[model samples]
Every structure is written in structure tokens, then in C-alpha cells.
Target: MKGLSWLSRLAGGLVRLEGRKFTSLKRCQDDHFLTPSKGESALYIHIPFCRQPCLYCSFHRYQFHEDIARRYFRNLRTEIDLYLDRGFRFAHIYLGGGTPTVMMDELASLLSHLKSRLGGAVISLETNPSDITSKNIALLKELGVGRLSVGVQSFNDRLLKAMGRTSHTGVEAQEKVRLAQGNFETLNIDILYNLPDQPPEVFRNDIAMVRELEVDQVTFYPLMPPLNRGDPLPPSLKPDNRCEGLFYKMILEEMYDGGYQPSTAWCFSRGRMMIDEYIVDYGDYIAVGCGAVGFFGGGLYANTFSLDRYSHMLEKGGLPVALFRGLSRSEASRYRLLTTLFGMGIRGDGFPRRFGDSPSNGIQSLVGLLQFLGVVECDGEELRVTAGGMMVVSRMMREFFSALNRLREYCLRYGI
Candidate 1:
């Protein structure tokens, strides 16, 4: 119908009316259920403890205490064992968090276990600006960290203060980057944009800062405030999707002119390097630790958000799985299409090779739909995200994460 065609164009061309239902979860006991596959997958470790919880952060986290953190680390190792015992093998490991470097020894121990077992698997880690110490950097290198991503949302003091991140100054953040730049194979900095009052000029300076630091990679995140129902935040801290799109327009021009390449929809790098996005690189990753999520074997799995629940379940010799849903065949195909296109675009044969069906099987008619709208361009051999399509992908991802953040908000609030 003419009306249906008009609606698809409005929804940005990758619309899914309903998603998978993951209401049921099973107790993860032995390795038999987690059969190994021939494909290589990455293992994601979520460090859920933070020195201070940022007000706008949506990921599940708790304030760090030495005693409790040490216990959490021990449990993390136990969780890793659960996967290994279940016949899973990871060629790469990504450590993400509420500041994975908050406790040095625990981080070191976890890496030690991984190195001994996985045998030179690539390791990646995340940290806050405060953790970028010479000692910490040295330790990270010693631990085989190939990629290090630092979350420096803004170099503007005003924005940093507004975000409740006061531990380090903008100057100190640059100094830390100076120290971290050459130590790892890839050094990536994360910057935030589209704040309540962030001007185009301020964002431009942040990009200049990236070049000045000479960091290998950069990831710009449009502000997606977490879902919360407590005292309201200032209007300045809220998200402006319209404003976000404008900033994204600037990113496309600035980064491209600067000679950076797309590592993902948001990540740009000066040279080839490992990106922090497991989703962009690996289709089927296993996420562990409280509040983490994973996709493997045609199903999506979620770990508990509550520390108490996470620890208790793992200690009882279970996988801490809180939710599980098997994606429909079409859903799986569409997912592959979404993620691949988010990066360098998809090879024409990618869908059929991965999903055993043509792109039309999962994407439905959206192929012709998006191409018709100038959102994407297709050569029979490949489909690539065009300059115009960047904003579309940005909004699409923002909406998806917003929904997930809502779930995180509810779980953390009611202790679900």
C-alpha cells in the first residue's frame, strides 16, 4: 500500500515491530548444554564495581569497597570457569566496566587466569581517566592488553562537572592519554556530545583534542541518559535526539576530513586497530558478570543485575542467567544485517553465508526500502552505509539502547 511505504521510510528503514521474548531462563549447570561451535567468539567480562557511580550512566554498577570487590573478583574467575567447563573457547576477551582498573590485583588475577587457559588470546580492557597511571599502564601491558578504551566523555570542565565526574580535570585527562598512547596496540578515547547545552564549538574542540592527543582511535557517544525515576536531573543533562543528529553530521565531516576510518558507526580510528566494540567485531559474544548480556546459539541471554543474586547464583555453581530468549529465524538474520551494516557494511553474500538465507529472508523488503530512501546503497555484491545513512543508524542504535537502559533502570531500582 502507498501508506505502508510511507511509514517504512519514516522509521529509518530498519524497523522491527516486536522483539524476542526472553521471559524464561534456565539454570546453567554443566558444560553439556553449552556445546562448542567451530566459529571463534569473544568472551566479555563485566566489572560491575565503580569508584563512584556516574549519575547519567545506565550500566548496572555498585560503589567499590575493597572487601566486597575482592570477593567479586573471585566470583568472576568462577564464572569464567563455568564457561570453560561448558566446552566454550574464546579467542578474544574484552573487559568492560564500572572501571575495570579500580583494583589492580584483582584485575591482574583475572587476566592471569585467562592467559594461562586461553593461550595468548587477545585481551582488551576499559578504564576511567583516573586509572591511567604509569603503574596501571605498565601492569596492563604486562597483562597483554591489546586494546585500551578510556571513557573521557568530554574535555570541557563544565560538561564533566555537570555529568558528576569530578575526579580528574580535563588537563589531567590529556596527560593520562599522553602516557597511555603508545603502550597499547590500540588506544581509544570515548567522547560525549549533544548534551543539554553543548554547542557545536565545544564539540569541535573535543575533536581537535582527539587529534592533539594523537590517540589511535576515538568513539563519540551521543548522550543517552539512563532511565531513572528519582529526583529529576537538570534540563542540561537530558538528551536531545535532534541535537544529537546535528552533532553526528559534524562527526561524519570532521572525522572523514581528518582522514579517520569507520571502525563502527560511532568509532573512528586513524589506522587499523582493534575496536572496543565486541558487537561490531564478533556476532556471537558471551557476556559474563552481573548485568551483562550475551548472544550465542540463536538465543539471547542475560546475567542478573543484582550483585547479591549474581554472586549467590554463581556460588551455588550456576551460570547466573536471569533471562533467555531464542530469536526467531528472521530476527537472527535481521540482527546480522544490522550489526554488519553498522560497520564497513555487509558483503552481498554475508547473509546467505551466515544465515543460510538471502538478505530478503530476514530483512524482508527493507533492502529495497532503505536503498529507495537514500539511507543505504546496494551494489549486488555489497550493501554499504552511505553518508546520509549514518544518522539513521545512530538513531536506530540509540533507540535500542534506550529500551535496554529502561530495563536496567527497573532492575537496579527494584532489585530485580
Candidate 2:
């Protein structure tokens, strides 16, 4: 246990160092991403408006304004057309917050445009618990949304209040879940764990409530607060990394005991289901909205986080991409390994097809180190995470997300 603790700290430090390299981005050129990708890619559309933003969130989001939101949706469509003109194709689409369902009319218009242009692509969307009304659910189903993820956070009213989530109470969230249970192909409920002032019994009861609800899937996210000043979460609501392993262990026992299986490190399901996090399914995704980030063709890029700049760029007939960073072969390889492992494991053969080299040739030493630590095991050409490695990977991913929040804070602060 001591050794695992040491490794977690070591991994966190290394990931933070790598994150610095990631955040140091350069000006993007139009020609850099013109060429079409080689494999299946998803489209991620960000809707950065929320009626009531959560205190624990660091996503790029603005307060709700109907006129501004309507204009933003128009600009968003223009950005999508830019990608379509570039010969990019997306069969899977994910719509993420700040509360994508805040405006039903705008959402319907956007969905109609996407279906017409993209041809019945499978759509996954996220919403707050308060937005799961009958009218909203009917519209989502009509729009052909196959997966709906509700950001429930927790079912304890005390925890909800502590997290500064006034959107819905414990019973209200459960009722919303009940309302949307069988309407979609997969209904995923998002829960946060290891929050400050959250007790073990609170988390335990939350998991038990999730099982009682019997939703299609449950995603338990470890709370990852921002790494800089002006954090959204108060000090009282900050996550305690020391308790993360304990929470994760409880998750493993309860979910498995409840007849649930892992679709990823953080997501558990009863059967085959679409997950909310698009990163787990598509290695390369095109992000096409203000504050959206994309990984493509060995480079990472982010659209302008400033809504004014984003609209201006689009209105002038240009993409809203503000920064791009071309990663080294080693860096790209490590990224693939990290995401794939987070989805549970990766086949060895996939490395060659994606990286143009075998796993041993590109990341053998890293894999070997993980193997030596008994965190992962290799059987012939297949590598998988061990039971002990789940928490390690969880911690590693938390650090990575914290790095992203740092980038988000930086961009929002400077209007980049």
C-alpha cells in the first residue's frame, strides 16, 4: 500500500510536467488540419451556457442569455460547415455542456442541421437533472439522441448543497432519472466521489441509490478541482486525493456486487452501452464550438474560448481554432496509451495501426515499467490493467484533467 501511494504521487508529478508541455501551444495554421483523417472520428460540440453553473466545475461556460445563445448556435453551425467543407466526416456526435438542453428550440435547430448534413449520426448529449422534463425528453428522442447523461453529482441533498448544486434535490434527481430511464438506448447518470465533507456512508448510499434506480450506466467521477487561483470550488468542497483510493475500492465492490461491469475506469454499465465521454470511443475527434478542444493527426488544438472572438472568426468565414500543438511521436504514443488504458485496456495490434509502429517499438519501456510494478499485465500481445492499477490510472487521469482545468482557467483569464 505504501508503495502504491508513492507511485501515485510519482505519477502525478510526471503527468503535471507533461501537462506543461501540453499547455504550451502555438498559433494554428489553416492548412495544418486540412487533410482528412484516416480512421473513424467523432464530433464534439460544446454549448457553453448554463443557467446555474456548479461550483465544482471548471468548464468554459457563461450565464444564460437567450439572445446571445441563439446567436451562438448560428455561429456554431457555421463552424460545423467549415469542417464539413474540409472533407471531414463524423458518424458519432457528442453534445456537452454547459447544459446543452438549456434552450430546447436552439437545440432542435442544431440537431436538425446535423442530421441533414451528417446523415443520422448517433448523438449523445449531457443535461442537468432539472432539464429532464417530459417535453425535453420527448424532443431529445425525436432528435434521435441515443444516449443521455444526466449530471446528478450525488443523491444526498447535503452533499448536493455542499457542492453548490442547487439545480435539483436528491428526490428530484431520482425522479428525473426515473422519467428518462427507458427512453434512450443508454441512460447514464454522472456521480462525483471523494468530495470534501462527503462521508463514506454518503458515497455508499449514493451508489446504492444508483443501483435502485437501475439506470443503464453510472459514471463515478473523482472530483478534480482547478489547480490555480479563482477556482470554482471552495476550499471546503475541494477533493481529498488521500481518500480517492478508498472511494474507488468501494465503487468496484458495490458496482460488481450489483451486477454492473466497467466500461471505463470511471463508467460502469449493465450491458453494452454508449458512454458519455467521447474520448474513450474515438481516438480522433473534431471539436466545433467555442472552448471545444480536438485531438487530430498527431496534434492537439483548441477553439477560441472567448465567445466574442469565436463569433467574430466564424462571421468572417474562418475556423475558430486559436491554438495548436504538434506532439512528438513519443508524446502521441503516450497519450494513446493513457486514454486506451482508461477505457480498461488496449490490444497490442491497435498500436501499430494508430502509431505506425508496434507497442514494443514505441512504448515498450513504459509498458515494461508498469508490468514490473504489477499495475498491468501482458499476455502475449494483449495488455490489461490489474485490479491494483485501476486506482493508479484513476489518479493519473485526475492529474491530467486538473492540467486541462489549468489550461481552461488560463484561456478564460486572458480571453484566449
Candidate 3:
């Protein structure tokens, strides 16, 4: 384990350098790049309106506005129509937010409309602790939401207050977790660790809460605040690597002890769990809401972060893509490999079917290097991250998302 730890850190350093290069922004060389195809891809709808923007959040979200939200819903339906008209089929929907459950009525209407198009599909929605009322929970279940993930950053009142997220007390957070529990196929509690000056015990208590509540799934995220060029970094978000590592180790230990298996590097659950992370599950997806990003047809495309621009573009009957970066064959394959590893393994036997030829044909060096360093091993035709390599994969995935978050910052800032 110690040797794997050292190699993982070394791999993290190398991956960080590659991530920086891979995520560097390029001008939108092609505005008319989207070409709808008859492929299966998940749909991600961004709810840009939030009741309140957390101090540490930089995702595309606005202070909630009722009238604007109503219009946004209408425009969102139109945006979905644009893709459907082109024969693009999506059977999985992941709703991310400002807060998807804030305007429940409109959200339900929107989901109904999406179901009409897809002829019914699984839906996963993200919500805040404050929105976990019996009414909202019931309404979401009625809307056929298979997964409900509540963001409860911490169970410690002091940490919640320190993070400026005391809108709900620690007690309220726990009650909400129980309230939302058992209502969906998978109830996921989103926890944050490596918080600035956060003690290891706080995370231990969080794991305890998960076990006590018997929540279906838990996602523990290491704090990965995007470095903004214009905005000064917040003092409260300075995360320590040692703390993160310790907390993750504790999480793996506790979850496994409790019979929770890892569904992803950061996500653990007792049984089948609905995952909202589209990347880990799908190689390509279409993001429909403002401030969302999509990867399809060998390119990474982002929708406009500006609500007005988004609605206007849909008003004019056009896709809301503001920028795009086309990926080469190598970039695409390596991306697939990374996300596959993040999900715990790469099925080598199916490599020819998914990417043509074999794993050795494109990213051979990467697979070999991982094996060479004991970071991963081949189980017949499947390659999986070793116990020691989870953190290494986590670091790499975190850096990749950090890079995308930087892209999100640009989109949010310039309203692109």
C-alpha cells in the first residue's frame, strides 16, 4: 500500500501536468459544430437558478427568480425539442443545479415534457438540504425520479457555519437526509472533506451519520475549488492534501466495514445506486441547460451560462452552444480510459467493441504504465484500479474536473 501510495502521488503529478495541457482553453473554432446523431447519450439539464448561491460554489447558478424560472422552463423544453427533432435519443436524464427542486411545479412540468420526448427515461435530480421537504420529496417521486442526491456538505454545525451554509442546521440536515431516504431507488448524501482547517473527526462523524441513517449511497468529494483569474480565492476553501487522503482512507474503511461497495471512486452504496455523474457512465452526453457542458461527436461543447442568452438562442431556434473544443482520437480514448478507471475498471474484453481494435491500439502506454507501477492490474480481460491506486485515480479525476471548472468559470464570467 505504501509503495502504491508513492506511485499514485507520482502518477498524480504527471497526470496534473497532462490535465493542464488537456484542459487548456482554445477558441471556438467552429460555431456550427453540433451534428445530431442516432446514438444513445444521457441528458443533463442545468438549473441555473438557486435559492441562494453558496460561498464556495462557482457552478452556473443565479439567485432564483420566479418569472425567469418559468420562462427558463419553457425554453428548456424548446431546447430539448431541438435535439429530438434531429433524431437524437436520450434515455437517461441527470438534473444538476442551482437547485432543481426549488421550483417544483415547473420542474415537474419540464420532466413530464422530457419524458414525452424520450418515451420515458430514468431521471436523477440534485437538491439542497433545504429543499428536502416531504412535499418536494413526494413530488419528485411522483415525477419518476429514480435518484435523489442531497448536498449536505457537513453534519457539523460549526463547519456548516464556517462554510457560510448554515441555512439549515446540522440537525435539520440529518432529518432531511432521513426524510429523503428510502423514498428513491438510491438516496445519496453528498459530503465534502479536506475542508479548510477541518479536523479528521468531523469526517469520521459524517461517516457515522451515513451508517446510522443507512442511506443508500454516499459521495465524498475532496474540495476542488476552481482557481479563478478575476476573483480572489476564498480563505475558507484552502484544502490540505494530507487531510483529504486521511479522510478518504477513513471513508473507504467505514463504508466497506458497513458493507457498502464503491460504485465510483468517490461514490459508495449498499446496492444498486443511480448515479448522477453522466461521465462515469456514458462516453458522450448532451447538456441542455445554461452553463452545462456536453461531450458528443468528438468535441466538448458548453452551453451559454447566461440565462437570457440561453432563452434567446432557443427563441431563435438554435442550439445554445457558446464554445467547443474538438478532441482528437487519442484525447477521446484517454478520456474514456480515465472515466472508466474512475468507475473502477476497464473491461479489456469489450475494448474492441467500444473503441475498435484493442486497448493496446491507442492508449497502450497508459495501460502499461499503470500496470508497471502497480497502480492497476489485469483480471483476465478487465483492468481495475488497485486498493492503493484509488486515491491516485481520485486525484487525476479531481484535476480533470478542476480544469473543467476553470472552463465553467470562463463561461459564467463572460456569459458565453
Candidate 4:
């Protein structure tokens, strides 16, 4: 058993090394599976500036810097030009950030350039409630932004403070939501449950708050433990297993009672609104900015995490891609399985016919075990994760990570 584990790790390491080499030479570009037939694509532009970093955020973000930001935006325009020259047409654009609303003027400029290039696209900008003033909202609407994704991490003031967020109070957040409800075609609010000090009732009330807001969509995500490589356990908040389980249970019960459909594990919709429908459908996206990841063709590429490095690369007429991987057929199939099973809670029968066989035999066996354990159900055509499975999607994803870790260990010990 020990030998086998080592062998798996060795193989995984070799695969990772090969991926690194491929990324270094930008050779992974050939593996992209562009959806030419779709003719439409999604665009994700990462605005890394934030008022302050959240305690639990693992994404690459930095505090506000005007000079640096201006430089970054220039590079961003260059990056967009690269894609425009490639004859890509985008239909949806998402500006995600540390807080996109922080740099309203810059964001508007970026959107203006994109609109001039793409003609028209459904633009969504993620923001915090405090940043969504009347003036900024009007500016966004004028700039052709139709959707707003508010980061209302939690309605609880205590939790909000703990999360290092100071944008708005619960009441203020509600007011912002009200303002955005009619203005934006789609309004998606993000809420987090299972903080270190939160209880089940608190989470229930949070859902009730969402119900009261009557926003188009609500994304309920459990608190993820800090992922900083150095400090495994950050002092701000810790993950509680029991509280997490109860939190999810409460969310499911309340959301269902509120007449929201489980669009995905973390996503719930009240009406027929589809905020991120393109990703679930066969659409393409271009991710630009530091630490932003883009999916094109069958390839996944990420820009440099360092702000300076990313800017320098882009200024030098490079893609700023620090790491990229060409997904093999099997790897792409596994990626789809992971995304679908966890995201939409639905698996397609056409997947197997399109991507060689069903997920690997190993994955099938794991799915069968999960089914027997009552975490999932298989109707032979489509597989669905039960409420229990949804509650532990994080754990299930971790299991895949564990398997990958074992594989990595094996590969490291024995050359693949």
C-alpha cells in the first residue's frame, strides 16, 4: 500500500512538472477547445483592488493603489485587443474583483472600450453594498452593465465585521438591494453561512433576509477555511463541522420554503433568472488580470499572480499567463464531471458519448459508493447529488483533491 501511494504521488508530480513546462513555453495554447459554433463568449475581468482583504478570501487581491491600477487597466486593454484580433465575440462580461465598484471610473472606461470592440454584451459587475451608491449605479447602467453581484457575505453585523468587511450594515445592504432590484436586469447577492461564531438560527435569518430582499438570485456558500499556504488556521474564523452541516440544512429548508430553486449547490434562484447560464451551457470565457483564470478551447490558463509581473508581461505584448494546462480528453471529462456534479447538481447522458467513456471507472466506483451512502442517486441516465451530497460538496471536492494528492505522491516517487 505504501509503495503504491508513493508511485501515485510520483506520477502526479511528473504530470505537474510537464504541465509547468508546457505553460512556460506557452505550448498549452494548442489544447484550447474553442466553441466556434456558439459564436458567443463570456468575459471575466478581475479588478484586484479592494478596500480591505477579507479574512477568509483566498483570491489574489491587493489594497487600492491608483497609479498601479491605471497601469493595470492599460495592460487589460492590450489583453482585450489580443482576443479581439483573434475574432472572438463575447456575449456576457463579468467584472469580478476585490471590489469592482471601488474603481468606478476605471471600470467604466474598461467597459466602454469593450463595448466599442464587441458592439454589445451583457455586462455584470460584482460589488459591495457600500460601493453601490446612486451615482455609481447610474454610471454602471449607462455603461451597459445589466447585472450586479453584491458581496453581502452575511447579514449579521458581527460576522460582517469578523470577515473584515465594512461596506454596509444589514439594513444598508437591504436598501442597496432595493435600489438595484429594479435598475439591474439581474441582481445576485452572495451570502455566507457557517462562520466560526454563527449558529443555525443566524443562517436561517440570513435566508429570510434574502427572501425579504426578493433579489433575482442568491448564492449561498458555506465559509471556506483559509487557504493561505503559510497559516493553515488563521485567527479570524475557523470552520466548524457541526455548525457547517446545520447551516447548510437550514439554508436548504429556508430557500426551498422561500420558493427558490437550487440552480446549483451554492446558487439559488427565485424567478426564472439565469445569472451565470453561459458557464453551465456550452459557452466560452476569457479571464484577464492577475490570478484570473480563462478557459478557451480545451485549455485552462491563469495569469501571473504577481501584479507587477502580470503588468510587465502584458506591457511586453505577452499574455501574462503564468501557468496553463492542456486538458486531455480524460482530464476534460473529469473536469466536466466535477463542475456539473457540484455546480448544477445534474449530469448529462450525452457526456459519455461526447467525451469517450463516462468519468473513469475509479470515479464511477466512487459515485456508486456515494449513492449507496445515500449522498447521491443515479437513475442510470442522470446522476443527482442529494441534499446530503450538496451539504458536503466541499468534502466531496476535497476527496477528488485527496485522490489527486495520492496520484501526485506516486508520480513523485516513480517517474511517469
Candidate 5:
């Protein structure tokens, strides 16, 4: 554990440094360059309107207003057409947001348009408990949504209140889960851990409830507070990182013992199911909608955070991309390694095939050190993360996302 702590600090520092590169601005020489390669890519669409934004969340979101949301959804379709016109094609689509299901008519319209344009793409959407009604479920299924992920952050009412989530209570969340279950190919429930004053027993009970409910999958996310220098979270609601590993260990032990399997470093499933983290499935993805981010052809770009700016850009017949950064060869290779490992393991020659360079020739020493530390193992050109290494990867991912939250905070603060 001592050694693991040291390693976590080292990995955290490295990821923070790397994440800083994403905050800078650079204009794309040609918007056409942002089009994803044909082979394997996904589309991420963000809806930034929420009824009430959570204090701990750093994603781009705004207070819900019907007229504003309707206009945003219309502009969202236009943005999608922009990508489609750029020759981007995707079979996997993930819709996430402030409350994707908050405006049903707009959502249905957007999905219908997607179906008419990009037929039969498997859609995965995130919703809150309040939106998991039978009507919504039928509408989602009709729209070709195969996976439904609910953001039931915790089933503890006190914890829920502490997190500033008031859409539903613990009992309401459970009932909603039951209501939505068996309606889709995969039913995922999100559970959060390591919140201020949240006890180990509370997390264990939350895991116990997951086993009782028998959902298709559950994603356990560490509480990552916003890093905006303004300190958005009160001290009473802050996340206690020191106890994060303890909660993670409980997750590993409980989930595995309950017949669940690790689909990714943070996601566990009962059997073959659709996982939420699209980066693990698609090598590249195109992000649409305001405040969206995407990676394509070795470059990372973000859409403008201001809804007005986004709409104006689309109105003028241009992409709403506000920031662009092309990663170097080494940085890109290391990124692939990080995400591949986060998905559990890297299998036979994936690196060489994807990057045209062997994994050994890139980030070899980092791999060597992880191997020596028993965090990863090499077997016939494949590398796998050890059980002991889960926490390390968890720490790495937490740091990566925390840095992203920082970027999001900056964008929101300045309306970039």
C-alpha cells in the first residue's frame, strides 16, 4: 500500500502535466482535418441544460429553460449534419448531458433526425431517475437506444442531499431502476464513492443494493471536485481523496464476489453488456453539441461552451470548435496505452496495428516499471493490468478527469 501510494502520486503528477496541454487554444488549419477516420469511431453529443446542476459536477451545464433547450436541440441537429457533411460516420452514439431527457420532444426530434440520417446506429443515453418513466423508456427504445445509463450517484438519501442532487430520493432511485430494467439491451446504474463524511459501511450498502437490484452494469466513479481556483465546493461537501482507495477496494472485492466482472477500471458488469466509456470501444470519436470534446486524426478539439456562440457558429455554416490541440506522436501513443490499460488490458499487437509502432518501442520504460511493481504483466506481446493495479489505474483516471474538470471550469468561468 505504501508503494502504491507513492506510485499514485507519481502518476497523478504526470497526468496533471499532460492534461494542462488541453487548456491552450489553437485554431484548426482546416475543419476538414477534424473528420474522423472511417474504421472505428463513435459520436458523442452533449446536452448542456440541467434542472439543477450538481455542485460536484464540472461538466458544461446550464439551468434548464424550455425555449433555450428547444433551440439548442435544433442547433444540435445542424451540428450533426456538419460532421456528416465532413464525411464522418459512426455506428456507436452516446448522448450525455445536463438532463438529456429533460425535454422529450426535442430529444425525440433529434433522435428521429439521427435515425433518418444515420440509420441503425446503436444509441446509448444517460438519464436521471426522474426521467426513467415507462413513456420515456418506450420512446428511447423506439429511437434505437440499446443502452440506458442512469446517474443514480448514490442510494443513500443523506449522501444524495450532500451531493446536492434532489431529483429523486434513494427509494425513488431504486424504484426507477426497476422500472427501467429489462427495457434495453444494457441497463447501467452509476454509483459514486468517497464523498465527504460518507462512511465505508454506506458504500458497502450501496454495493449491496446493486447486487440486490441485479442491473446489467454499474459504473463506480470517484468524487472529483472542481479545481476552479474559486472553490466551488464548500468544505463540508468536499471529496476526501485519502479514503478513495478504500472505497475502490471495497468495490473490487464486492463486485467480483457478487459475480460481476470488471469491464473497465471503473465499470463492472454481470455479463456481456455495453459499457459507457466510449473511448475504450472506439479508437476515435467526433463530439457534437455545445461544449463537446473529440479526438480525431491525432488532434483533440473542443466546441465552444457558450450556447449562443455555438448556435451562431452553426448559423453561419461553420463548426463550433473553440479550441484545438494536436498531440505529438509520443503523447498520442502514451494516451492509447493509458486508455487501453484502463479498459483492463491491451491485447496482441494493438499498438503496432493502430500506431504503426510497437508498444515496446513507445513508453517502454513506463511499462517496464509498472511490470516491476506488479501493476501490469506481459504475456506473449499482450499486457494485462493486475488486480493490485486497479487502484493505480483508478488513480490515474481520477487525475486525468480532475484535470479535465479544471478545463471545464475555465471554460465555464470565462464562457470560452
Candidate 6:
């Protein structure tokens, strides 16, 4: 029995060692880029309530219930007060969620609290097309909201139904965009491509629609499978490689023809470039609400994903933080790289200045390869993704991830 107990202890030790190794590897890969010398402060508020969950969405969202929302908002106010006491100053505020508009009163209260704490800040809110009414638009304008990111997904009714979106139709979406333009300085539309049963021609038509709408910016994201393994995928959409590649290419061509520039791997813009400016300048932000992640003061943290838990935490005078990680210098660097690549699509020559050391050979080689593929072109010293490359930005990001993974595996195997 003693021998058996000793064996069990040995097994436990091995398991712990493996876990530590894995964590270390992940940390190293995450921190491979340079940390910003001066970090920006941004606020993000997550509204977990949604009218209904879209089939492909896995974000932490709940169905609209006034009682639940009211409780959540009360807790959120408490959380904000706690942060303000901690001396956190934020410049950018983002309200995102299942549907932020669903909790209009709560949103107003939260914004009021934020204004009291931070004074003047660049406030942005993301909402579904269905939620944007004239009243909501008026409220947003009155709140001094500078940006509105509307989730339009697609203009085609068939495609929208296939994607299981309960929001506005294509026509309704256009009207909302028109309404939003009158108030917000930056109006952004979020569109998705490679949807189930979406044809190549649909993308071309969508681009035309975007051009006609003449909004400030457009974000084009490819369809990502729902994170829940048990959720059944649509019959028209499979994880097939060829179908995805073709659709991606078609979307890229259409976007380029419409004169939309790539701001991130999955985002594009037209008039005023908000994302590019943020990434390049390292704009500060604050993130609030359930499952919303925030970076400030050289640390990254996320709120609790559970609504009940989050509310309880707030009531107890604690931030609804389920996970918190203070980034080491190396970890901050890697995050910057990932953010820069995904956000701005610009490879700056001033890597050593931003990060601490020169760019790794692996990253340089990847850039070179991308350049060779005609996906990126060298403008003087700056590396910019070309139109062709923008189509497969997700694939490119995967390639970066692959390299990071390899590095991690090597570190684990050799105990580095």
C-alpha cells in the first residue's frame, strides 16, 4: 500500500511538471514581441444579454431578461467604482456584447458612471442591426458616443437566415447605417463572409452595398465555427479547406475593388481609420462586464464569464475577474506582435524600439514568405499586406500561430 501511494505521488508530480512546462511555453510564445514602453488605457464593457444567440456565435451572451439585466448593471456600477478607486484612467471606452442595445437603461447608467470617472473619452459601442432604433440612436448621440459598430453580417436574406441571425434584414441594416451616420463620427459595419450557402456573387453584391451605404468603416470577418463542440453546423457550411479558401479569395477581391483597406486580419475601413490609429498609437482602453478582457498598466485581465458569479463578485466589492495575468516583459512583446499583425496589418521597421530586441529570424522569414506570395509588399522599410494577402489574413495569422506553437513545443521538449 505504501509503494502504491508512492507511485501515485510520482504520477502527480509528473502531471504537475507537464502543466508547468505547458504554461511556460504558452507564456514565452505570447511574450515574443516587444512591450509598449507606455501602455494605453481602454475600457471595455461586455453586455452579456442578447435577444437570441446566433447559431455561429460562442461569445458569452444570455437571452434578454430585465431582472437579470438590472442586477447585472447594478453590479457593473459597483465594479466601475472599484476601478476608479484604484486610480485607473481610461482614454477609450468600448461597450460590446450579445447585444448592448438590449440593456439601454443599464448602458445609460454605465455611461453616466464612466463620464463621471473618466470625464471625456472616446466611447464606442457595438450592436446588432435589429437593436438600433431612432431612440437608441438619440440616446447614443446624447451620451457623446463617438463610434458605433453595427453587426450587419450580410445583406442577402437567404444568407442571413442560413447563418441563424435574428437581427435586421439587409434593407433594415442599410437604414440603420443611414440613421447611425447622422450622429456618430465613426460608423462601422461588421460583415461576415464564407457563410453557410453563401455564393461568391453574394460577396460582390455585399461590397457594393457597403460602398453605397458610405459608412465610415467596414470590418470583414470570415465565418468561424461555433466553439461549442456539440452545436451542429449548418448543412451548407463545413470545415472543408477548399470551400473556405475559394470564398475567402472572392471576398478579398470584392473588398479591394470597393477600395476598402485592410486594417486588421478580419477588419477593413474607409473614412477615418480608428483601429489603425489605436494599434499604431497603442491607445488605452478599459473593458468591463462579463467575459470582457482589458489591458492596462502592463497587465491583462478578464471578467467572470458567469453572470451570477460576476454579479456576486461586484456585490462583494470585487472585480468579476475569473482570470488575471500580469504580463512579463516578454509576454507583452508577443501580445504586441499579435495585436499589431491582427489589428493594423503593418510590419514596422522599428521593432527593436518597440520590443527590446531585433525581430526573430523566424518572423522575418515569415514576412519574406508573405512578400513572395504577393500578399505583402515592402514600402520602403514598412511591410504592408497586399490585396491578395488580405483575403487570407486568417491563414496568415494561423501561420504566425504555427511558428509560436513550434517554439513552445521546442521549449517544452528541451526544458527551455
- On the 0 to 100 scale, the lDDT of residue 336 in model 3 is 84
2 against 3, candidate with superior TM-score: 2
List model 4 lDDT by residue over 301-375, tens digit each.
666667787787777776776545666655555556555655644556844443445445345675676677565
Residue-level lDDT tens digits of model 2 in 339-381: 8778777666664465455554458788889989977888866
Worst 10 residues of 4 by lDDT: 407-416
Give candidates' CA RMSD values in order.
3.4, 1.9, 2.1, 7.0, 1.9, 10.7
**C-alpha lDDT values of all predictions:** 0.77, 0.85, 0.80, 0.68, 0.83, 0.64
On lDDT, the leading prediction is: 2
Error of 3 at 360 (Å): 6.5
* Residue pairs with backbone atoms closer than 3 Å in model 5 (clashes): none
Model 3: lDDT equals 0.80
Judged by whole-model lDDT over C-alpha atoms, candidate 1 comes out at: 0.77
- Candidate 1 residue-wise lDDT at 154: 87
Measured on C-alpha atoms, candidate 6 has an lDDT of 0.64
Residues 1-416, candidate 3, lDDT per residue (tens digit)? 54556665676677677666665546463555566666678889889887877777757677898999999999999998888887788878899987898898899898888777677688898999999888888888888899889999888998887777857888999999988877888788889888885788877898898899898888988888743546666677777665567777888889999989877889888966545578888888989888788888887887777888888988988888777777778888888888888888766595555566655446777787888877688776677888778888888887777777877876666657
lDDT for 255 (candidate 3): 92
- Alpha-carbon runs more than 4 Å astray in model 3: 25-33, 226-233, 273-276, 358-361
TM-scores, each model vs. reference: 0.92, 0.95, 0.94, 0.80, 0.95, 0.78
List where candidate 2 sits over 4 angstroms from the true fold: 1-3, 29-31, 226-233, 347-351, 355-361
Q: Which stretches of model 5 miss by more than 4 angstroms?
A: 27-30, 227-232, 359-361
Model 2 alpha-carbon miss at residue 257, Å? 1.0
lDDT tens digits, residues 186-215, model 6?
Answer: 888988776658777887789889888877
